[model samples]
Each structure stands twice: as C-alpha cells, then as structure tokens.
Target: MVQEKQSDRQQRLDNFLQAVEAAQKVQDDIMKYGLEAAHLYCDDIDGDWLETWEEDEDGQQSFVELVTNFLQSDDLVAVKVRKQLKDKSLQEIAVNLEKCLSLSEEDDRIFAVKKVLLRGVAVAESNRGTSSDEIDEIELLDLAEELLDKLAEFLVSINR
Candidate 1:
C-alpha cells in the first residue's frame, strides 16, 4: 500500500510538471504572436508612440495573445470577474477621473481591466515591457506611470 501511494504521488508530480511545461509553451507562443502584432502596429502607427509604452513588441505580443486566448477559452468569464474584483479595490481613485464611465459585467471590460493590471504589474516588477530586469530606472518609472494612468482609466470606466 505504501509503495502504491508513493507511485501515485510520483505520477501526480509528473503530471504537474507536464502541465507547467505546457503552460510555459503557451506563454512563449503568446509572447511571440503579440510581438508580431506590435511590430505591425508600430509599422503602421507611430513607432514613437509604442516606444514609451511599457509593452515592447514581445511583451505586447505576449499580453495580447494571453488575453485573446483567455477570452476565447472556458475561463473567459471568470477572468472578467477577477478583474472587477481587482478594480473594486481602486474605487476611491477612479471616482476622480473625468471620463464618462459605465459599469458592465461584460467580458470586454474585464479583459481590459486584466490587461491594464497586468501591464502595471509587469512595468512595476520588471521596469520593461518585453522582459524583466532589462530596463533602466528611468524607463521603469516611465512605464509604471503609464500603467498607473491606464489602470486609473480602466477603473473609472468600470465604475460608471
């Protein structure tokens, strides 16, 4: 019985490792796709506009892909709820924003909130859009500011 239990534990560990590997692969794919999209957008729009943005071609690609996949998957609605919960914590600051806002249980708003929050965290933690630990102090600060602005905007939108 002890041997069987040990075998079962080992099997579960193997399964968890496989799941982690799969998740990593998915993340890599998302980043690649998002970067391509950013590059295209940069080519068409102002590259300079994206320059100050926290997400580099790669980071943007990852974010976009993750968001897209999350939205399309079974977890779509749940992701939104998570964003709203996060946003709710920022209600005080959001109340002061000038933009006309409206509340929605809609998937889009939740997705937007998640993106903003992720971007903010990414900027704060890594100080770079594409990858962490690659950015200078000034760049990181700038990205954090931008992310905060977006977060505020998202919160305001949802509050209304």
Candidate 2:
C-alpha cells in the first residue's frame, strides 16, 4: 500500500511538471511569433515610400496571421494556467507583464496595460479588504504605466 501511494504521488508530480513544461513552450512560441510579426511590420513600414508601400499589403497580411494565431493559442494556455493556479503569484504576474510589454502595437500594448491595471486593482482591493499589509496601490499603478511607456518607446524606436 505504501509503495502504491508513493507511485501515485510520483505520477501526480510528473503530470504537474509536464503541464508546466507545456505552458512554458506555449509562452515561448507566443513571444517568438509576436516578435517576428513586429519585426516584419516595422521593416515594411520604415523605408523608402514607394518600396515600403509596394510590399506593405502582403507583409501586413502575413504579420496579422502570425499574430492572430499566437494570441489565440497563447491566451488559451494563459487562461487555463491562471484558472488552475487561482492566485496570481508575483512571479506569474511579472511574467505576464513582461509578455504584454513586448508587444509592438499601441492596441496590443493597451491590452497588456489593461491586464496589469485590472490585476493591480483586484490585488489591491483584496488586500485592503482582508489584511492590514501595506500594499502600495500607487506603486502597482506606476509599474503598469512604466511598462506601457517602455513598450511605447521601443515601438517608436522601431519606427524611427
């Protein structure tokens, strides 16, 4: 019976590890495709007017497709993991924030901004209502704004 119990525990551990690995792979793929699409879009925009214009349509279409697939797959995995975890630990929240800031477009950046802000508000409210820990709501809001600014700057540099 003890041996059987041990084997069952091991199997559960193995399953958890596999799930984490799968989640990481999804995150990596999302970043890879997102960055690639950003690069392609940036390149097609920042060049001689006629040359860039000629290639813009096809490049934009390809970039859009890549981004669409990445978002759908990555968001699905993210939602699943977030649901499973229930509480978003600081590390997990940071990872998601980083991914959001890496997006190149204003609309994409806004999505990330909204996510972080929403998370911050939720965290703050929960903490305030429950415990007396000094949770700095202003700090959390500042961090989100900083991320948005950094992403905007990066995008501007790509355009220039």
* Highest-lDDT candidate: 2
Per-residue CA lDDT of model 1 for 1-160, tens digit only, reads 9999999999999999999997886677668796564453345564466554644544443233333333334553424423423433333223321111233433444444434445445645543346544535454344334434454444454334
Task: Kindly give the stretch of ten consecutive residues in candidate 1 with the minimal lDDT sum.
Answer: 92-101
Which residue pairs collide in model 1, if any?
34-61, 35-61, 101-160, 102-160, 103-160
Question: For model 1, what is the C-alpha lDDT against the true structure?
Answer: 0.45
Q: Model 2: per-residue lDDT, tens digit, 6-25? A: 99999999999999997887
Distance from true location, Cα of 34 in model 1, Å? 1.9
Candidate 2 regions off by >4 Å? 1-90, 102-104, 129-143, 151-160
Once model 2 is optimally superposed onto the true structure by TM-score, how far is the C-alpha of residue 46 displaced, in angstroms? 48
